[model samples]
Target: MKKEPIIIGIESSCDDTGVSIIKNRNILSNIILHQEIHKKYGGVVPELASRLHDVNITKAVNKAIFSAKIRRHEIDAVAFTLGPGLIGPLLVGASFAKSFSIGLGVPLLTVNHVQAHILSHFIQDANLNKDYCPKFPFLGLIVSGGHTQIIKVNDFFKMKILGSTLDDSVGEAFDKIARMLGFYYPGGPMIEYFSQNGNNKKFTFSKPTVSGLDFSFSGFKSDVLQFIKNESRKDSFFIKKNLSDICASIQKIISEILLDKVKKAILKTGIFRIALSGGVSANHEIRRAFMALSKGNKKYEVFILKKKYTTDNGAMIAIVGSLKYKRNLFDSVHVSPYSKFKTF
Candidate 1:
């Protein structure tokens, strides 16, 4: 029998530095180091994020190898995220991956950040049942701070974008609203936590109108901002008193907007298999909504990634790398990092 190739994936797309080692479809080790310094700034500072990635990348790689119980020389390929992220951070990971590939005499793999997120479902683990994995030709809804896209995944590397955001991403809207509500930098989780105690119907926000499967969250964000400003003027403590309700209302509308488009995509394409990916996929409301949708209808089969894989992580990158390696797809050392989104 042929031995499975071992791949090391490096992800420094944004505030997190993630490193992972995988053999075949199983993850041996996945290490993620988050930059907490951005909390005070209310958002990721690109320069600081890059500098920190430079400082943390080596340590993360070493730790991942150690945790995976593998020697550096045993790696068959080095994979790293190449784009759709902050340029500085992407460069940090890409440069290291190139150097690592050369040092180990192995092939280098460049993975698209968004593709990794969607492929994360393929990552195998002892606790995950193989039956839960989605088959080919599934709809992938990627919701991250930087991107909002609905992709049709026909194969491991074959994907086509069906729709995308015209303005701000859903994750960005969550973060901005969370900051306005006095939450920390990554406000999605906080909003979820608080919304649990409030009623989603207590307040209402206008949803954006967009044609086809496309999404537009900028108008929704503006509606929230204007409502807050108008209400706060009337009652100085309005936000303080209705924080939970406000969170619930916004969360509901955001989740509805996403699901609405997803339903449209399903109806248009006649595909019932749906998978959620990217950072915003971690939103509790979003996950729950997808779960409810699947339960309410037998035709829809929903696959929600584990929370750990939902955000930017090396495990997702490594899984994509493993798939690409099987097909002999490798990148040259001269490959450069890009900041714009690309479909695989």
Candidate 2:
């Protein structure tokens, strides 16, 4: 029997350094080392992130290989996130991946970070969701700290951006709003937790009027800031008294804006199958909203990656690597990490 090729995936796109190994679409092992120091600053510090990645990459990769119980010779190729992230972080992972590939005399694959998030759904699952998979010609919502986009995925490599944010991403809005509420860095989960018991209609924020499927959240964020400022001046303890309500209202408006665009994309593409990816997809309210929307319409089918793969992770990178490797898509040795890149 021919042995399936084993591939190594490395990710250092932001604050986490991740490594994973996969064969035949099955994830053998996946590991992620998060930079916790950034929490003190309420957001990722690029230099700190890159420094931590440098410290963690080697150990992360070694652990992944050991957990996979694979010898160095078993890895057929190496894949790494190459763009659309902090240049320093990208370089850390890209450099490591290139060195590993050369040392192993294996092929190299450079993955687009955002595209990897969309492909994450294809990662092998050994649990109850093992058989779950979405067909082609679907809408993909990419929501993370750095990006918010609606993509029409016609095939593995054929994709079209239906819409994109003109300013802040959904995750950014969550974090920024959470900051306004005096929450720590990475406030998405905190906001979601508080929103559960609050009235979502307690506050109203104007949505952007961008034509077509494009989005604009900068104005929404500014409105939120202004609202909080005005309310605080009226009542010194306004935020303390209405934290839950504020969270609920903010989450509700963001969810509506995102789904509204998805609705538009559906009409434009005539596709009923939609998938949600990126870190923000982990938000309970957003997940619920997407699922509810799909259930309300018999024609809609929504796909969301497992919580583990929802964030920046190497499993997504590995899955994309495996797919590209099958088609002999390999990167040259001289390929460099890019700070900015676009996916079709």
Candidate 3:
């Protein structure tokens, strides 16, 4: 029997420095070093993020190797996220990957950040039930800090974007709204936590009138801003007093917007298999809505990644590396990292 190839994936697309070692589809070790320095700023600073990645990349790689219990020489390939992220961070990861692969005499692979998020479902781990993995030709909803899109996945490499956000992505809307409510950076989780104690219907926001499967969160965000401003003028303590209710209302609307587009994608494509990916996929409300949609109608089969994999991580990148390795797809040493979104 042929031995499975061991691959190392490096992800420094943004604030997190993630490194992972995988044997085929099975993850052996996944390490993510998050940069908390951006919290004070309420958003990621590109320069700071890149500098931190430079500082953390080597340590992250070493830790991953130690945790995986593998020698550096045993790695068959090195993969790194190459696009749709901060250029500085992307360069940091890409340069490290190239150097690492050269040192190990292994092939180098470049992964699209968005593609890794979607393919994360294929990572075989204890947390993921093998039977729940989506087959080919599934509809993929990728909602992250930088991107939001509905894609038609025909195969591992063949994906077509059916619709995407016209303005702000859902994740951005959540963070901005959270800021308005005086939450810390990465406000999605914080909002979800507070929403549990509040009523989702306490307040109503106007949903965007986007046509087709496309999404528009900018208008929704503006509505929330204006409402908060108006209410706060009347009573300075309005936001402080109704924080939970506000969070719940905003969470519900965002989740509904996402689900509405997903439902449209399903109906238009006639595909019942739905898969969710990216950072926002970890939101409790979004997951709950998707699960409810699936359970309410038996015709829909929903696949969601474990919470750990839902965020930006190297395991997702490693899984894509393993797939590309099998087809002898490798990157040239002179390959450059891109900041704009590009299809794989």
Q: Supply the global lDDT for candidate 3.
A: 0.91
User: Which residue pairs in candidate 2 have backbone atoms (N, alpha carbon, C) closer than 3 angstroms, thus clashing?
Assistant: 159-344
CA deviation > 4 Å runs, candidate 2 = 126-130
What is candidate 2's local distance difference test score?
A: 0.90
CA lDDT of every candidate: 0.91, 0.90, 0.91
CA lDDT of 72 in candidate 1?
Answer: 92
Q: Could you list the CA RMSD of all candidates, in the order they appear?
A: 1.4, 1.5, 1.1
What is the TM-score (0 to 1) of candidate 1?
A: 0.97
Error of 2 at 118 (Å): 0.3
Q: Any residue pairs clashing in model 1, and if so which?
A: none
Off by over 4 Å in 3: 126-130
- What would the per-residue lDDT of candidate 2 be over residues 1-344, giving only the tens digit for each residue? 97788999999999999999999899999999988999998899999999999999999999999999989998999999988899999998988999999999999998999899998888876211336778898898999998899999989899988888888888888898789889998899999989989999999999989999998988999899999999999999999899899999999899999999999888888999888999998887788888898779878988877789999999989999999999999999788877775654
**Model 3 over residues 64-155: C-alpha lDDT tens digits?**
99999999988999999988899999999998999999999999999999999999988885233345579899999999999999999999
Candidate 1 lDDT by residue in tens digits, 210-292: 99989998899989999999999999999999999999999999999999999999999999999898889888889889999
Please say which candidate is ahead in lDDT: 1 or 2: 1
* Count of residue pairs whose backbone atoms collide, per candidate: 0, 1, 0
